[model samples]
Target chain A: MSLLSVRDLTVKFSNRGQSVTALNGISFDIARGERVGVVGESGAGKSITGFAMMNLLSRPGYIDGGQVLFEGKDVLKMSAREQRSLRGNRMAMIFQDPMVTLNPVLTIGQQMVETLRAHRKLSHEEARQIATVKLKEVYIPSPEARLDQYPHELSGGMRQRIVIAMALLLDPQLIIADEPTTALDVTIQADIMELLLEMCRSNMVGLMLITHDLGVVSQVTERTLVMYAGRIIEAGKTRSIINDPQHPYTQGLINALPQQTPPGSRLKQIPGSMPSLNAMPSGCPFHPRCPLANDLCRTTMPKVVQYADVEVACHEVQRLQSDLTSEAAQ
Target chain B: MLQYTFRRTIAVLPTILCLIVICFFLMRLAPGGPFTSERPLPPAIMANVLERYGLDQPLYVQLFTYLKNIFFNFDFGPSFAQRDRDVNDIIAAGFPVTLTYGFWSAVFVLVLGIPLGVIAALRQNSFWDYVMTGFAIFSQIFPNFVLAPLMVLTFTLALGLLPGGGWNGGQWEYVVMPAVALGTSYLANVARITRSSLLEVLGSPYIRTARAKGLPERTIMIRHALKPTLLPVISYMSPVFVYMITGSVFIDVFFSTGGIGQSFIDAAYTRDYSVILGLAILYSVLTFVLNLAVDLAYAAIDPKVRSGLK
Candidate 1:
């Protein structure tokens, strides 16, 4: 069974007397030990998906309709206590900014021990030992000394390592990291991502990484989902999607990468910004900026269709594929 | 930490000196003397009285002598208006009452105000939040002078559940009316501050991480949210606490509580130089000390401040 299966998940917010749909119906699944990367531009509801899956959306925002089935049990149907137990223990989350993830007033050890004791009945010593071990696992030197230090005492890279250690304390089956290294320097980001990937691989823990950096995703994730305007526009094996993008939007994202342009040449970019949720366009959300948009694309949302190993949601892709097949037959 | 404390302690000396000079000069600047009575005394008798207290000396001599006496013996001198009583004796007798009243009121402010604020912030736009917001606004609008009488009328006359006014040897019943009267505005201030600060903290990324950690709501609030929320509240409450202790003159008069607050007002009205100067110096010292304590508490609770000190 898949470790997490999020099907037809929709999240909405009643912001300022107007209903805003932040995440339209989207479906995906992660099996044990699988690593999936969710890549999108800002405001594409990437972080909201992580929060909604954990049932952590607060105020104004609500899970309008969805099924988040974890281990064959619907999360929406779970009692508060059950959800609490499943959280931190079975599924954990790492955040973007390390400085903000750890409580400022709490010592490193205290925070880690608190997480452990919350889900299990463990003595302070036992929890502290586990915390120290996890800190060592994240390659923190003098882990024992670090337990007594506060978040502000650590460097940015060290703080992120401490956050990762806290997330692993309970040995969660699935970890949802939302832009976990976005706040760090480039060198630190590489080390942190490598450490995370190695840790997940050794423990066979499933990871759902949400990021805007295509480079980071290509290195760490097996499968990739490209989101646009609150919907999944394309998804496939990371290698296939990166190498052979079917949807025009996905193609635009890959082309816009810095490496795709020659030196001294201006980089390519999508024509328009993502639409505001309150004033979203009809039909395909990406049609306004899509180079291949047609009449059907502007009038109706396209259904997802399989293109080889990839699933793409664009009418132009279907036409191109058929045209290529007919030309090959001739 | 030790160096910080020592530096802070040394910093109080110049503050106290400045306070002493200002209070002494200001008290002398006022229009009347301590012995100004309905009928003027004979010149001979006044001369004798002035000589008895060394008031006949030059202003600089008197000021220097007063400073010398306090520095060497810690004496605040005898009350010029009250017979056979010293400033120290009056403060010793009266300050305890004020402290008790202030302490109890602070208890009310913390016990009632903080939880109310936390709940209001957590609930946000709910009915309970609306009710608490209304209560906070109402309390702030009506100052203690206005609230005290209203409380007395209701609790003392209408319900007749408690005494209207009296110290009553620090009985719990006597304390209830005065504490509530003194604490209402402070409670309102604290609640409003807590609610706003906590609301901001609740939106922080750490709070979101806490929620994601699967910890219970109570744990997330107390463990993750409350400390940062209190950073601003602590700084705000320090001055409020000193104000409660030293600025309760109206409450003291209304409740007939024999606290130093009443003595302060009486000394001010009577133009008793020694008593007024002594109390002013005491309040200045208290304010400095309380502010230092708040800073130390801030450093202890916030890692950023603590590390900055190092």
Candidate 2:
């Protein structure tokens, strides 16, 4: 059984005078110790999915229909007190901007110890000891001295590391990292991602990484979910999606990745911008941007179906697959 | 800290010197001699009066002598309006009364303003928020002179629970009207600043991070929100404090309290240059000092400032 299952989650936002749909019947699952990569462009409802799972969605935005089952318990049904207990203890979240994630006035150690004391009843001395251990886990040097230094004094990479350290301290079963490494330098990004992957591997922690970077999804995630217009258009094992993309949107995303074959080669990009949540295209949301779009694609939303361990939603995938096989034979 | 104090002190020297020079010259320039009372005095008697205060000397010589006495000896030459009474002694007697009243009002505004603002911001469109905001606006929009009399009429005339004006009955009760009159305006200012700053700080990402950490609502407010909100409030409150210390002439006059404010109004009416200039110099100096203290406070609250100091 999956450790966490989200069944037909749909989130809608009321804007101006209309009920705008942000997430449309998206569903997925995470097995124990699984690393799932949720890839989408900005406003693709990837972050919304993460927030919904945590029950942290902001105002004017509500989960109209969804069941977020964590360990077979419905998160939406949990009391505020129960949710509070689960938030910092059973699941922790690390945000994108490290500078803002940490309070400017508080010392790194103070913030860490407070997090510790919030979920677990411990003496100040015990909390400090745990904080020092977590700081060391994230490879911060001089853990004792760094504890007293405020957020302003720390470097960006160091602060991000400290945030990761705080998340791992409670040994949470699941961690929702929403583009946590996007703000870091390219060089530092690899290191932080490696650190997160290693920690999750060792601790048996399930990670839900939300990002638009396909390369990162390939490197760290075992499973990848391609979301478009607030819906998951394609999802499968990482290798299968990258090597043999079934959905037209997934193929476009992979093709759009910068090529290594030639320096001056023209880069391929998706034709149109992601549609606004205010007014999404009917039938299939990606149909307007799909090259393979036809009359049938415009009139009907495709159903998600399983084929060879991959779940794809497209009417023409079967025809395209056979045509591509014949071309490969030639 | 030393550099801050030295810079502030150096900047104030000119203002102090200008007060001394202008007060000395303008006092001499006032119409009629000091002895020119309703009952006219003879020339021989007036000459002795001028000589006794050293007004008989050359203009420049008299200025130099008075400057030396005030700046070096800390002497505020005897009051010409009231014989045998030293100017310094009169200021000393009156300054404390004004200071006490102003200090109490400052404390009252801070105590009341902060929580009211925090609650209003948290509640936004709620009932108490509207009530407090409306009350604060009404008190501030209505002039203190008008508000003071209304308060006296309500509490003294209608209620018959407290005295109307004077610092009579009890010390605490004496403070009630002046403090309320003074604090009503300042409290409104504090509330407005706090409300705006609180809203901005509440929207900051760190506040969300604070909430995500599962901190209780009250803990999040006092620890994470209040500190940054107070930064702007402190900067605004400093100037208000200085104004209160200098005294609001209308409130003093309406109440008939013999405080420095009343003395200032009397001096300005008669164009008593010594008293006017003395008060001006003291007011300017106090304002300058408070502004410096506010700067230090800014540095203390923000770490960027502390490192910038070095």
Candidate 3:
């Protein structure tokens, strides 16, 4: 069974008498030891998906309809008590801003120990030992000393490592990391990502990495979900998707990468921003900016079409695939 | 940390000196004397009294003399309005009662206000949140003067469960009405601050991390949200705390508590230079000390501040 199967998940917000659908019935699953990256621009509901899956969406934003099945158990159907236990014990999450991810007033040991003791009946000493081990697992040097220090005492990279250590304290089955190293230095970012990937691999923990960095996603995640305007526009093996993106939006994101352009040349950028949820265009969300948009694309949402390894939701991609097949036959 | 404390302590002196100078000059400038009674004493007696207390000296001389007495002997001289009683004796007699009232009021503010604030924030737009918000607004609108009499009427005259006035020989019942009246506004202020501050902190990424860690709501609130919420509340409470301890004069008068607040008002009205000056100095010192305590508390509670100290 998949470690986490988020099926037909929908999240909505009611802001000032208007309803906004933040996550529009998106569905995906992660198996044991699987690493999947969900990449999207800001406001594409990438973080909301992580929050929604955890049942941690704050007010004005809530799970409108969904099935978040962890180990084949519906998370949304669990009682508050059950949900509490399922969290940290079965599933953990890492956040974007490392500096603010850990409680400022609490020592690293206190935070880690508290997380351990929350789901399990462990003594302080036992929890501390476990925390120390976890910290070492994250490659934090002299992990024993780090436990006593507060989040503010550590550098951003160290703090993110501490956060990761806390996430691993309970030996959770699945860890959802949302832009975990977005706030760190470039060098530290790479190091943290490697550490995270290594830890997850060794522990056989499934990872749901939510980020907008296509490069990081390609490097760390085995499978990738490219989201646009709250919908997953494309999904496939990360390498294949990065190498040959089918959806125009996914293509736009890949082409806009700085490495794709030569030295000193302007980077390619997608035309227009992600549409605001309230003003989302009819049918296909990305059709407004798609170079190959047609009348069918403008008014009707395209169904997901499988092309080789990729599952892309775009009429143009489907037409192109069929045209290529017909031409090859001729 | 010790060096910061020492530096803070040394910083108090100039502030106290400045307060003394300002209060001394302002009091002398006011058109009244302690001896200006309806039934005035003979001119000779008045002159003798002024000369004896060294009040007849030039303003500079009197200022210097007052400073010398305070610095060297810690003398606040005799009250000019109430013959034979020194400012020290008056404060000593009244301050304990004021302290008791202030202490209990602070307890009430914290014990009642903080949790209520936390609940209100957690509930956000719930019925309880609206009710607490209304209560906060109501309490703020009704100051100590207005609230004190209303409390006395309700609890004293209407309920008849507690005494209307006086310290009642330092009994617990006597403290309830006065403390509540004195603390109501402060409670409202603190609750409002805590609610807003906690609401802000609840939205912080750390709070989300706590929730993601699977911490129960209570643990998340107390462990992750409470400390940062308190930073703003502590700074806001410091002055209000000193105000409570020095006594809300109207509260003292209405409740007949005979606390330092009443004495302060009486001293001001009669222009009792020594008593007024003494109270001013006391208040100044309290303000400095309370503010220092707040700073220290901030450093202790907030790791960022603690690291900055290092």
Global fold similarity of model 2 (TM-score): 0.89
Tens-place lDDT digits, model 3, residues B173-210: 99998999989988988888989999999999888888
TM-score of chain B of each: 0.96, 0.90, 0.94
For residues A1-330, could you state the per-residue lDDT of candidate 3 as single tens digits?
888898889999999888899998898989899999999899998999998888998888988897999888999999999998988888999999998788889999998889899989999999999998888878889999998998877899998888888888878899999999889999999999999999899999999999989888988999999998888889999998999889989889989999999989998999888899899999899988989898998899998999868999999888988998999999
The lDDT of model 1 is 0.90
lDDT of each: 0.90, 0.83, 0.89
Which of the two candidates, 1 or 3, achieves a greater TM-score against the reference? Answer: 1
* Candidate 1 chain B minimal-lDDT segment of 10 residues: B243-252
* Candidate whose DockQ is highest: 3
Flag regions of model 3 displaced more than 4 Å. Answer: A16-18, A324-330, B1-7, B36-47, B56-61, B153-163
Task: Put the candidates in lDDT order, highest first.
Answer: 1, 3, 2
In angstroms, the error of model 3 at A24 is 2.2
Look at candidate 2 and tell me the lDDT of residue A309.
59
lDDT of 1 by residue, A133-210 (tens): 999999999999999998888999999999888888899999999999999999899999999999899999999999
Model 3, position B197: C-alpha lDDT score: 98
Candidates arranged by DockQ, highest first = 3, 1, 2
Clashing pairs for predicted structure model 2, backbone only:
none
Off by over 4 Å in 2: A15-18, A260-266, A307-309, A318-330, B1-49, B56-64, B296-300
